[model samples]
Target: MSLECVHMPISPKNLLVVSHRYRSFQKDPIDLVSPYFDNVYVLVRFNKFADVSKYVHIPALQPFISSSKIDYTNKPLNLEVYKTSMFNLPLDSQYKKLGKLHLSVVEKIIGENNLNFDLIHSHFIWSAGYVGAKLKEKYNVPFIVTAHGYDVYDLPFKDDEWRSKIEYVLNSADAIITVSNSNRECIKKLDVKTPVTVIPNGYRQDLFYPSDTFKCRKSLDLPIDKKIILSVGNLEELKGHKYLIEAMDYLLRIRKDTICFIIGEGKLESRLNKQIKLAGLEKNVKLVGGKPHNEIPLWMNACDVFVLPSLKESFGVVQVEAMACGKPVVATRNGGSEEIIVSKDYGLICDPARPKELAENISLSLDKSWDSKKIDSYVSQFSLSVICNRILDIYDSVLSN
Candidate 1:
């Protein structure tokens, strides 16, 4: 549905969004949702003591350091973002205490600015959702939390203590919004009484859309003759980049014409590089570090097929972005990819972490003739306007009652 068809209330409402970062998947929805609200107050939480660059001396790890700095020059007009930091030592044991500490920081910001909102919409469970839950108690506002990826599927199930903490944050919210049915099922495992809704994450249509393959390849200086496979995501363990590298090894043995480009930076870069070297895929698989978010579309358009070899995902929005660019996807049956590539017509889905199966599917995707327009048309339902409208409907329903 178009944004024009979305119902708007007579009186304007203000929204407060508490999130981990103001970029990519988190920021896209807020940008789309901003036009519907009078004011969108975004509170971004950062750890002051988490700067690894200051302590670590390794050169390879230098690029993966977490930065609290955010460029606000391009933010939306109605969106007023407040970034706050807390001094929390980087330790796994210290995680549960972060919620209260984060809440304290948010309370200070809200008090100093005298910020008020009709409702609280927070992303993630710990820290942001916890802060939103506490703020709801103080202000008596409807609180909503979106549980994305690791926060839902991985964190809570680690132990009993964490499970209780995650459950408390979820139960406190007026409503819970998870990205996929896979995530919704994870929430159901917790047995929380709060109403849960499945709202898949969306891609920016303006940034990622159908483009000429030859032009995109020429612009990016990529080889026009080679069959290019692209994967854009952090080079982390959960992302399953190593498996993709393995799959590339298998593909190279059959066809020397294919080359895979892995984008994004992380702690696993050195390890993945070693694996690539050992497998003798040095010429085929290129670990082209993180590219700017805007430049991703160019890479997407230049590739023959997009591959997502994630071990687990609440929602793989990158797959949607690739489909938006009119490219066929070869993804593993990670929780989210199966939902997006429901039919083989859209793309191919293989078992996660299996090099042989991933290799077979990647080969099939490369050989198959896919309709670019059909792929683009199929992904339009995941546009920002459609996602934001559904979210707005949830906001209206929560506030009206």
Candidate 2:
């Protein structure tokens, strides 16, 4: 395929993005990248609530762009393709199947829409990267990939075939990016030739800043006097909630007044509840399901400490939010957390699967004193504007090449 370069007077080379599960416009990189581009379009596979177009805020932004949805509910394709199944199957199985589906979908989009995208920016390497590579083969357009953790860590274990698919995307994408340097190293271990960049997940700090702790606690019906510990992630085994519950067992042994809140729903919710009961921590720990993203900073401010004990992570965004709210954090050494947490300065790092260590770290984060201003200052490195500008530079370098 002969790739044609298109120069735009007002915007970036027309870009097409593919994200199977774009939470909302607030949670999208495409939205951040849109300002740096001429026209941007995102194609999402399946939106269960028919909410992708409604909740995602791309339509509001001008500059000649559109958001389109594709129906895959009844399609012969596997539903789990391009979706996270919470560390159940080997990571590679999900990636391989997802790669195949991605190729098929991209072909359909190009043919049906008569599209002319100068560059393809895929959100994840599993489905989007694979599809982007295939599109590059057909359209000859350069494509860039974003690796959001699990796609690199969980997939290659015990499955060589699936690992190859990841390698293909990593090596082929014009520029590769992950949420952290830890993840960049993981990709390097795969011997990928493409340039890989470490871009920590960025957020709109203006919207996600800290609020008055007293008012937030009162609004949430949480006790004002007791110290609160917050954790936000899908309730799954890899999230290591079991370890968090076990940590609570230790916290209560010393400070009986502490309360731990685990937010976000998942299949392991029932099992996590059972573990909580077994630990005799009914009063100390509570499992609260997922809440809107906008309401998270309030939860952060209301808590004294934020704990993220994931067995694996690309980058833990919740930890950033906590730090941004001037709250201390206790996270695991795995993946991105090791790079994000500023050691004993901002948060403590312990083994996520080890209950005793997790407990000790959580207690330390809550009881100890770290300069809140320092923690907040460290978090400013990951501000949306900083990361977005870096991303734009990467895009510019790719286009110039």
Candidate 3:
């Protein structure tokens, strides 16, 4: 039998996209969605350099696929797609001025190229969504906004002023997309009724998956004999790393050989370091700081278990990434983890801030005999291609109406 490929109805049109992570193109959804559009213009926030890595290593960099000649030597790597261009905000600027900046940019693009975009898509509900709503009103184009992690669980509920702004943005959009079921509920709480769809952020399998265990351990200079337990997140209060570190007391109480590595850097670094020092876990638990995004899979492969102890998570995309790496996870009962860790075979779940429960689950996960292949198979639906197709379906549905 011959196989034929069927795709969603494709219309070649210009797409004006807004995102906060355009500089880090590897995880940007626009990097995946841009290929399907004739042109995609990305407006990104300009900030201090967080990483020293060269732009050439960006896995999503597609210079040849772009329509503009952008100088990559610049701090912010800009690009074009049939007509896409990424603009970084001027220093000493704020997102509150995004509407003004977007108006100026759109005026120039429409006048110079005589272009009219079919729709606008924004990532995150703050600056990007705010600008998308403005463009929708100014140009009368359909708009879509996706809320990820903190944007869903923190911003809207943080203050009444923020709630009002976010509510208006969601109410104004033609369609709303959230990364987790937990976020959909948060949107509903705003009392705005625009259709909300759950589309999780997908992980690239090429970047995150099971690899040669020995080489992975050797590359990271991690010992081969220890039972490694890993947690990858910023050392923030919301991440609940303090509790994970507390749980380690119980872990070490039983198994002296077990080690924990907490990755990512944040303001809470000093506090977490103090916690480790006070607990006398300096050797048992190490703060590896932030590693390159591509190196995360090596840690997952080397570690026996991956744990995310966030008190409240929107989607916990990293947990799915852990699952794809063929390692079992011990995550909290955050909305996202509850859906991902549906069965005990994948791993175990406990309350977010409970050290006793977390330690128990971690112990149980360590003792469990997990089938790596089965663990990897469970996350097949969250692959980048599959998630993008579902997003495209949403795009088609919105445009057809």
Candidate 4:
């Protein structure tokens, strides 16, 4: 198909994009949208030692210039500034002025770039959206914001300051986009005036799919004899890894051959380890540090079931990935899970924060003979091409207006 034939009418002017996760470039919607723009200016914070992964290293598409460099080194100077720039920090630091320093630096970067942006696109409400609201004020540019999880669900709304700041961004932005219907409802409760659009995060179908299970397992040096149950997410309390571990322990008790592998890492790793040790699952549960995002499909395909037990999520992008790999999902009935995991068909949705329920549902999933076709059908809804087209349509509607 010709490029012109497929693309909706969109003029590439200037799009200043900001996101927290460009490090995982493949999952970034802005990366998918870059082809439609004349210039895509991205602003992202990257850990000092983390390599510039797939998304940032892609050979530039000329005439569609894009560049960004966020200093997130572990040095004391950068660390001090980062601490002050943090948004929606815990109650102890809620009154702190971290967001102020963060915004100042962000504003300076916007100014220094001399970017004559027609609009600002911020990912999430607290950090990027908050910064975008300021850019809208200073430059009189039409700004749009996208809300993803923690920005809305994790923030303490009872606090007047956090509530006021988030509401300010929501009300001030020219447009708002969320990844799921659930997120839209959550935003409306915050009294956001900006019209909210539901645009899901997408996967690179070309990169992720149901692959040779044995080959994937062999490549990872995992035992071919075990029935793998996999969970992918940062090791965090909210992610509900503890619940999955509990479920896995129960499964192992019943079927001693089952193994659970967790991918991704965070501060919660230690706590999770303790849980696994306490449960006597140290031999069966493996906490593998984060693999490159592109390599996730191999792990997904190698597993019999994919679990995302997040107590809360604006949208669980990992669930979609599991479906894409033709594996059934068992997730919690938290934020976005309801919007995506319909019911007994696509995957199981257990009560949020309940380990026993999670174990029961997981057992059911393991017993059932899942239809691979159904799995593919479920994930296809959020394919990158479909999501990119939806976002392009949104941009088209905005620019056309």
Worst 10 residues of 1 by lDDT: 59-68
What would the per-residue lDDT of candidate 4 be over residues 49-90, giving only the tens digit for each residue? 223223442222111112222322211221111111223323
Write the residue-wise lDDT of candidate 1 on 211-320 in tens digits.
89999999999998999999988777889999999898888888889999998877788889899899888889999987777889999999999999999888899999
Global Cα lDDT for candidate 4: 0.72
Report the lDDT of model 1 for residue 295. Answer: 89
Better candidate by TM-score, 2 or 4: 4
* Cα TM-score per model: 0.94, 0.83, 0.83, 0.85
Q: Cα lDDT for residue 69, model 4? A: 29
Q: In candidate 1, how many clashes are counted? A: 0
Superior candidate under TM-score, 3 versus 4: 4
Whole-model lDDT values for every prediction: 0.87, 0.72, 0.74, 0.72
Query: Model 1: clashing residue pairs?
Result: none
Tens digit of per-residue lDDT, candidate 3, span 178-266: 88888888777887889998988787766777888889999999999988999987667788999999999878888787999998766
- What TM-score should be assigned to candidate 4? 0.85
Best by lDDT: 1
Superposed by TM-score, candidate 4 places the C-alpha of residue 280 at a distance from the truth, in angstroms, of: 2.1
lDDT of 3 at 244: 94
Model 2 lDDT per residue over 1-401, tens place: 11112323324467777765545322334555665555666665542333332454332111111222232322222111232112112244453565665567566766776766788888877777788888888788888988887788766543777678788888889999888887877777796898878888876676556678999999899999898999998776778888888888977887777999988765677788888888888888999866766677889889999999898888888888789888888888777788887668888888768888888777777778778888888888777767777777777778777
Each candidate's number of clashing pairs is: 0, 4, 1, 3
Ranking by TM-score: 1, 4, 2, 3
